[model samples]
Target: MVVIDINKKYPEIWEFLAEVPDPEIPIINLVELGVVRNVEKEGDKVIVTITPTYTGCPAKKLFEDLIREKLIEKGFEDVQIDTTLSPAWNTDWLSEATKAKMMADGISPPTDDNKVVTCPNCKSTNTKIISKFGSTPCQSFHSCNDCLEPFNYFKCHR
Candidate 1:
């Protein structure tokens, strides 16, 4: 049996894992989605701690497969992904940088204060909510009067 050194292997795992993008939004990786919580190693097996974005998020299975595949690609024969729901998933887990990227990508980011969403195309504060549901359950549809562009607003996750 070969012994694995976690300190040296974990960074490689992180780098390789970064390649796994979110299925819903391919622009953002799972790490940025706050799905990957921690990475640990015991003996020759690697353990990845993950938190699903939602209770019934379908992407969770894809994420698990991606992690396993990436680790295997990196030559780690044994890999285990552990899902944890404790502490739960909240919008607070989203990084400010990620939010900015979302806005730049024409998707309004979620605000902590539940403020009205601004138009991503025109940067206008004068936007009207069109529908409570957007392209996804986590977003709302809005139309901007300034640019006449309809955009999706990331709903404030509570």
Candidate 2:
């Protein structure tokens, strides 16, 4: 049997969670995605609260499994992962660092205006949307005249 002190264990838990990446955007970890809302420990059980990026996002199931696996690997046998949709998700939840990372990765970060997306490749404010849908549902495909590079724009959320 493994014993863990909740207060003493959070640092390790945070570090472990940092390893779980957003399945769709592997470049960004789920923690950076702002999906992990809270973590608590009740005796031997570890409770994790997650806010989904979208209501019907396909990655939800995968994220649950990944979280469970990660906790188990970290010596937490009784893990309870609770997903909450109440507050819903907004692109605003993304950290500035995460946004910058996305831009650096050639994936256009979300804009303050849901409709107008910037070009990641050239950092051009002048861009046109090719399609509302990009490689993923959460993103839109766009091309920049300045750089002429096609990139995926993170769709602005409500």
* Angstrom error at residue 46, model 1: 1.1
lDDT of each: 0.81, 0.82
Number of the top TM-score candidate: 2
Candidate 2: residue 3 lDDT (0-100):
21
Write the residue-wise lDDT of candidate 2 on 2-85 in tens digits: 122224347778788989988899889987887787788999999998888877788989999999999898899999999887
Stretch of 10 with least lDDT, candidate 2: 1-10
Tens-digit lDDT track of model 1 for 29-96: 77777778788889999999888877877778888998898889888999999999866777776778
Give each model a TM-score.
0.86, 0.89
State each model's C-alpha RMSD to the native: 6.4, 6.3
Find the number of clashing residue pairs for candidate 1. Answer: 0
lDDT of 1: 0.81
